[model samples]
Target: MVGQWSGREARALREAKRMSIREFAAHLGVHERLVSKWEAGGDRVHPRPVNQAALDTCLARSDDIERTRFAALAAPEPDSGPRPDAGRSAAPGGYSNDAELLALIDTGAARGEGLAAISEKDLIMAAAHEASEHAGRAEGTNIGPSTLDQLDADITRIANDYVHTPPMPMMVEMLRVRRRVYRLLEGHQRPSDTSHLYLLAGSLSGLLANASTDLGYLDAAGEQIRASWAYAEISGHNGLRAWARGMHALIEYWSERPHRALQLAQNGLQYADSATAAVRLHNIEARIWSKIGSTADTERAIHAAADASSAAAADSLHDEVGGVFGFSDAKASYYAGATYIHLGLAEPALAATERTIELYRTGPARQRSYGAESLARVDSAAAHLINGSLDGAEAALLPVLALDEDKRIAQLEERLTGVRRRICAPAFRGVAEARALDERIEEFCGSTATRSLPPGSG
Candidate 1:
């Protein structure tokens, strides 16, 4: 009685509770013949619910029925396929560990070191190897949320560094990473796990768009942005989608599609209710309003941006903002200045520009140089023009004109053209300086006629 029950013992146990085959068959809701087949040991009976209940009834005082029932119902263990400590640290399906390798790249970048002289092909190989190891570790164990989060962080850091240093190489690596990550995620069973993958895809899409924009490939940039938007939507990441929309608006603004830019900016603002993204979207909205010569709208958007930025500063413990969307107070000021400039509010424009220059001076060197030089040129020219110093205005613009034509600061080029045409008054009877500045701008712009001002008053 103490030993494990065989087929005969199981049948005797079933019948000992005063249950005949017909009665037990009735209790089990099955035909008596089927119950007989089980009890007769014609074929070994696996414990069905009726047999289990009958055994439980007969052994009512026994302590082992629960164990017996569980053993009968338990599913077979799945094959783990590979072990972490095995010689092969990859899953049966050849999964890679790109996440850890990406982490190493990010750590190197944070220290301002290059990628250790590793070629793109080799770096990718390392990433694959690491991914395989991670998969092997994950095979039998459940992959936790923290592990996935770390993997995401690693990918973001690597992509950020890649974009900053060598964009082409980063683009190549990103495409490969994308394929690998997608395959790994294919086996994921959870919705939250899939969300992380979507977020990474969105980040890569935005990075690709940015690189394409920098390279002057607008069509490609547009395509990347669309892809990013789709991924962001899938990820349910509102802020990132808004940021991408803002960049898309910027492209349209620069392409001279003011109305379309304004529409896009409005759409971006709708999704950008979060503090940081709201400030950025508001800035883009202000820029669009400036392009369309809408002074009221420009002022409104700038004020909203400033308010949102102030709220963001108050809420954040650290000054760092998250994601690929880069928005700082200095950038806000720069956009504010540009808005005022288009509105012909020269004094306010000068004030905002000076603030931007001050902020930039304390920040990154390259950004500082670009902002300081451009702001100095515009501020000095505007100051001179306002004070009736046509000669001085020309002198200030001369230095700026002498620098290489930078499409990054295209607004400066436009402003110089305006200064040249507007500084033609007789009170500035010395037409020679103004004429020379005009010709220099014309040469730089590669056009004989002045560029058209934004619509309305100007």
Candidate 2:
């Protein structure tokens, strides 16, 4: 079953029906833009709940031939018809399957083979042999290599999609995938396979932690991050450990616990083996230091981040499975801008924000994060406000103000709140332009992404 269709499945279904994007959208009663977005999202993006239902209905109404085409397109793999020993009958001296093997044991019991007649050591050896036979029948793993590969791919997709996709849809996908991982973990597997599963679980947990933080559920985020940390430890994955620690530090920072956040970030530095992870930790530390009003410490951390970024290295978590786990130059600049804002360094903040915006624009199309870009815009506006250029501030915030409400994350709202406060300062008091901008910001904050999240999402 093509259950809970993602963009990949949806596109496959469309192709199977031999319909273009416009035709598919018309059939599904949605705008063509949404279909394009889904197709662009590939396997990572999920349509809205209503659209998901529409897709489900469309698939349900498909004929067998169409379903066959979808199954082929959605999952193209070499056929290995069946297991080698399929339908083989038992030989006179041996069994063909587990059931036949069990029957052989029962026959022995029927021939007056009693436990009392067998020596204790011999019986123990027999039991061990039987268990070994069962364990060695095929493979101990409930999942095959292909399944693991698919899981790995899905994890990478989710990680890459987290920044661009809406939080609710991304969270839904995360929860579904996490449950699949949990079910796999509940079954028996080789130690190596178990470790891989744990690593995936940790990554998903860390992502969920970040989502929870974005939704203003600090307590939930804290619990989720702890689970991520535990999974990372079990998996013995240093990269995941570092990323989880960074996420925890971010949650603490937003919770207004600068000391705890700093401690977390400092501890994570030890596990940050890759340049990206190290840079992320250093940037986090710089932010915490800024929050603590320690300009020297903040500057030192910022320089450390720059040093770390220079020594670029591939990391399993940050580089290979990048999305929210990544710390790009643009994101680093955004972090620096945010830190500068807290330090009241308007000039540096403006410079950092400009670099951030430029990098985001000029970087790979897939890597451009709207949320990060919008936040940078807010930071730029804040710097302008600090410089007493109301016109510049207003200009800087135009893009942010134009953002879709669904993309207006809590952090963006919080930043805008700060900007509004700045606008309400004595210098801007009684100014009609400032009052108008303030009102607009207030309205924007009123309907944020977090606020619109469905019930029980956390």
lDDT of 2 at 118: 35
Q: lDDT by residue for model 1 over 1-458, one digit each (tens)?
A: 22333334454544443344555567556676655554434124455655555555545543476446534433233477642323422233121233323433544541323443334554567667757755654453234657666656655555435412434455666677666556756553366667767777776677777656644556787898888889889988876678778878877776778888888878977776567778888888987897788888887988888788756332110122232355666767777777776676767766787687677668765334452356456665775677677776666566556654332334455566667556666655576766776677778665211122224511
Error of 1 at 112 (Å): 71
lDDT by residue (tens digit), candidate 2, 1-458:
65677877887899898765666899999987777667645566799889988998999999999999998988843467753333433333233333233334545631344433334443355467657755673355788869889988988899888887777789889999999999999776788999999999999999899888777788999999999999999999999999999999999999999899989999999999999999999999999999899999998998998899888676888998888888888898999899999999999999999999999888887888888899999999999999999999999999998887777888888899999989999999999999999999998898888777678744
In model 2, where is the ten-residue run with the lowest total lDDT? 91-100
lDDT of each: 0.60, 0.84
Candidate 1 lDDT score at position 178: 68
Query: Candidate 2, which segments miss by more than 4 Å at Cα?
Result: 1-131, 134-138, 454-458
- The best candidate in terms of TM-score: 2
Superposition TM-score, candidate 2 onto the true structure = 0.72
User: What is the lDDT for 425 in model 1?
Assistant: 61
| Clashing pairs in model 2, backbone N/Cα/C closer than 3 A | none
Question: For each candidate, what TM-score against the reference?
Answer: 0.53, 0.72
